[model samples]
Target: MNPPVFKPRLSTSYLIVDDHALVREGIVRVVTNTWPHAHLSHAASLHEANKLLAEPGASFDTVVLDLNLGDSDGIQTLKTLRAAAPMARVAVVSANNDLDLALACLHEGACAFIPKMGSIDHFVRGLQTLASGGTYFPRDLLAQAQQREGAPTGVQPVAAISLTPRQHEVLHLLLQGLTNTLIAQELGISAETVKLHVSAILRSYGVANRVQLLLVCAGQDDSTAPQTH
Candidate 1:
């Protein structure tokens, strides 16, 4: 029997943001190889990224970002991109391996953090996961995060919470790093309804946002103590 051929489940549209030409080209090559039919765009700085994102008909499934761009740096870069393209999953590809920074990126809405020092295969796998509606955080960073002291306390597991069927659906998509607008489209519901469900889900988890909920789900921390509904 022949070995099975690998194929991506979806044709993704990607926006690669990096100030370094070589790094950007390397990511573009990896993405092209992994998903041969994928659509790709590029931005060398935060300003350029914002311009592309603001263009009419601009839409991307994922954004590969570097935190140390000439015009921006640190978690703020991820935050800016998140604001500009709320629907696109932002994956931070950086040389920095600081666990706190990685957690901060996740907390601020980045779906994945890919270390630029990692192997090509690692990058490929991260891209694959993101393309399939999943979030990717490096295991080493997650392990360090688990050992950190900042996780919330007293938060309950996801199964311990009572959730409506629709809320459950929304939660599933949310964990996959989809924005409210994306989840609304997926569930064929209004964004406001999705937002309500998200808020309820956060309350049930005793967390304030998706990142805290993710940490709780991953058994990271519960320092974010429960809030009364």
Candidate 2:
């Protein structure tokens, strides 16, 4: 006989705030996967979100709010929800990878920054973290900040001339333009994981792909400005 299969966990209702329909669907898929009994609603703008809250409705167990709402800006959007539902746990979902912005959001009491392309597991974990009374920053932002504090001279070069330790490694291998397999071998991780990191790096920097990522990574001097976030 086979062992019993596990069932999806259930939770209270959740709200999704995003201008994009597909993003809302993805959030629903991830949230419901973790909380099968969860009742969810979506809003395309801050106005709609407020209307939903004001209507005769049950309180949300948690709210996943987009910082860049169609009618609202980043941290300001978060501030509105804080006033709208003072008791609800709110998470900031955004694509902004700026360190200053991430810190500002956290300072303003956003429960987390849920990246659009971040894995579902990370997203769920962020929600859980908020549920547990902690805030969240994207892993990259947190890592970069920590490195700056613990290391010297903001990790040097201050521009494309310099690289974060990770970027340095990626740049070196990128110069070779080797197959994904070669880079994976040098890094000692699976090729697939490398691909994901590369994709994230490119997206964060708004580059076309690996070649551009490398080109941008190179051709910088010590005084050159580092890319945003």
Candidate 3:
């Protein structure tokens, strides 16, 4: 007589790596609470995360990883994940008390940054968006970062990063906070084309969102960002 092996099924799997169980449990509960049908998994350290991901057929649709994982911390965690799962969507789950680290995570490869310290409603919305294939940057932090970085109001200031001619024009319009449709209307181009340029802009300046991209480029003394066709 032979025994049969049972196979596991996963509609979609999620991974989380953090040192704290409370944080991990909270997120696990939240995720399962929202996505009742999804298969959930976790790791307490970067090493454990690596081991899990290395196993064959071990796949995760979205990884809500903590940047400050015990031994593996900061932007390094992001870089490692990017190298490990180049195709997987990643969101940096972090404490909201710091903006600099969050921004740094964005500069890396994280498609979005989620602040863990917030109303459950807020965290839920962010998780939902991440699961739904969209970036989830904290709205309040994005605004604050934009305002602070928008101005070069600091001592020993250096010239902000510059842009190319095309980038210059696109970046300026970005400063206006116009949507792709509006930008196309103003530039007399297809909205789809405007999206292409915005994608390039995000890549060029190493920014995660348009607000940060434009804020960084707006400080430059450039007159080249063309307006209207």
Choose the strongest candidate by TM-score. Answer: 1
Q: Candidate 3: lDDT of 115?
A: 83
Q: Residues 1-229, candidate 2, lDDT per residue (tens digit)?
A: 4333222122367788999998889778777766677789899999999998888855875678888877998788988886776545567777776767765655454546667656767776666544433345556555564443332213233243323445444443443333466668877878897777666555555555543343233322312444322
Model 3: CA > 4 A from native: 1-11, 148-229
Q: CA shift at 100, candidate 1, in angstroms?
A: 0.9
Cα lDDT, model 1, residue 130? 64
In model 2, which runs have C-alpha deviations exceeding 4 angstroms? 1-11, 118-135, 146-229
* Residue lDDT tens for model 3, 1-229: 3333212122267888888999889888877876788788889988898898899998876678888877797789888976676545577888754778766765565656778887878787777755644445676765677665552223121133434445545554554334577668766889888888888767656666764653443333332222221
Candidate 1, overall lDDT? Answer: 0.74
The number of the candidate with the highest lDDT is 1
Q: How close is every model to the real structure, measured as TM-score?
A: 0.71, 0.54, 0.60
lDDT of each: 0.74, 0.60, 0.65
The per-residue C-alpha lDDT of model 2 at residue 200 equals: 59
- Off-target runs (Cα >4 Å) in candidate 1 are 1-11, 149-169, 176-209, 212-229
lDDT of 1 at 90: 79
lDDT of 1 at 134: 56
